[model samples]
Target: MTNELTDRGQERRDSILDAALTVFVRDGYHATKLTDISREAGCSVGTLYTYFENREELLAAVLQKVQAEIGNASDEPLEEDFNRISYADALRASNRAYLVGYRANAKVMALLEQAAHLDEQIYDHRVARIRRYIDRNRRVIEQLSERGEIYPIDDPFMFTTALSVMISRLAYYTWVEGFFDDSDETLERVAKTIDDIWFRSLGLKTD
Candidate 1:
């Protein structure tokens, strides 16, 4: 009985999140109301509030879910075996995984892109998240520097900040701008762009 009830609760939560994604992506953060989300979720406003504290809280939850999905989709390892991976190969793998993930979560990417224009908090949230991800890969940056694959930068943090902005711009364009035709060509172009930018930035020889 307890297990059945728990499953039902999980189902309801997922239903709310699914509905919220549609509403938030279509109407955006500022314009979407709790009542709107409630109706979409097939629940009453009171029930919606029972699960979320407020609109901001609900938006945070939705963003969290989107981030989690993107993270999972981007989880391709840098190597078949971690100890055997070259720095260049790891960088290429990471870039490829990120583009794949962004494509998979294009809707959330679109919503965030739109929301950032109107909300400073949303913009800052994205910047902070990018910083956090870069920080997690500090060892990779350091390794590249030690091998002289990248220029010796005194500050990895500053290097990552600038590099992240460039990479983020490319991902945004590829995922949101519709600049490339929907084909293998587009994917190949994105991957190559990522590789070229990182290679040039790190002072590596490029093809």
Candidate 2:
């Protein structure tokens, strides 16, 4: 009985967060109200309060949820033997993972970007999330460098940071904001274009 109650409670929380993303994505951060989220969530305002104390609290929860989603997806460390995979194959695989993850959570991602600009707390959280991923990618780049698979870099951190932000920002504006024609062919083309740019910067050649 206790287990069932906990499971159901978590489900309800997830639903509320999902609804929050929907409204945040549609209306953006500055304009969204708790009632807007409640209505979108199909729950009463009181129910929303039961889970989140205030607007700030809900926004915090929403940002954390987005981080958790991406954090989980990126938790796996790169293989120890990095050279086993071809450079182009590695680029394609990483690009696909990033693109798919961004697409899956575009709404939350878009909301976070808008909210981060206005909210100091949220800005810190967003920065932390990016830093964590960049640190991990830095290690991977180092391992690849050890094998001479990647070009020498004086600053792995900045290199990874620049590349990550470039692709991620482009993904957000292009796919999340629907700025581009994201039909299957177009998205595939976008991914290919990104892969090529990334390869050229890293001096990786595809056979």
- TM-score for all models, in order of appearance: 0.79, 0.78
Best by TM-score: 1
lDDT of 2 by residue, 53-122 (tens): 7776788788787767665554432442444756567657766766767777777787787778888878
Report the alpha-carbon TM-score of model 2 versus the true structure.
0.78
| Top candidate, metric lDDT | 2
lDDT of each: 0.74, 0.76
Q: What is the lDDT of residue 117 in candidate 2?
A: 89
lDDT for position 89 in model 2:
71
Distance from true position, residue 154, model 1, in Å?
Answer: 2.3
Q: How many residue pairs clash in all the candidates, one count each?
A: 0, 0
* Model 2: ten consecutive residues of lowest lDDT: 74-83
What range of 10 consecutive residues in model 1 has the weakest lDDT sum? Answer: 73-82
Shift in Å, residue 182, candidate 1: 3.9
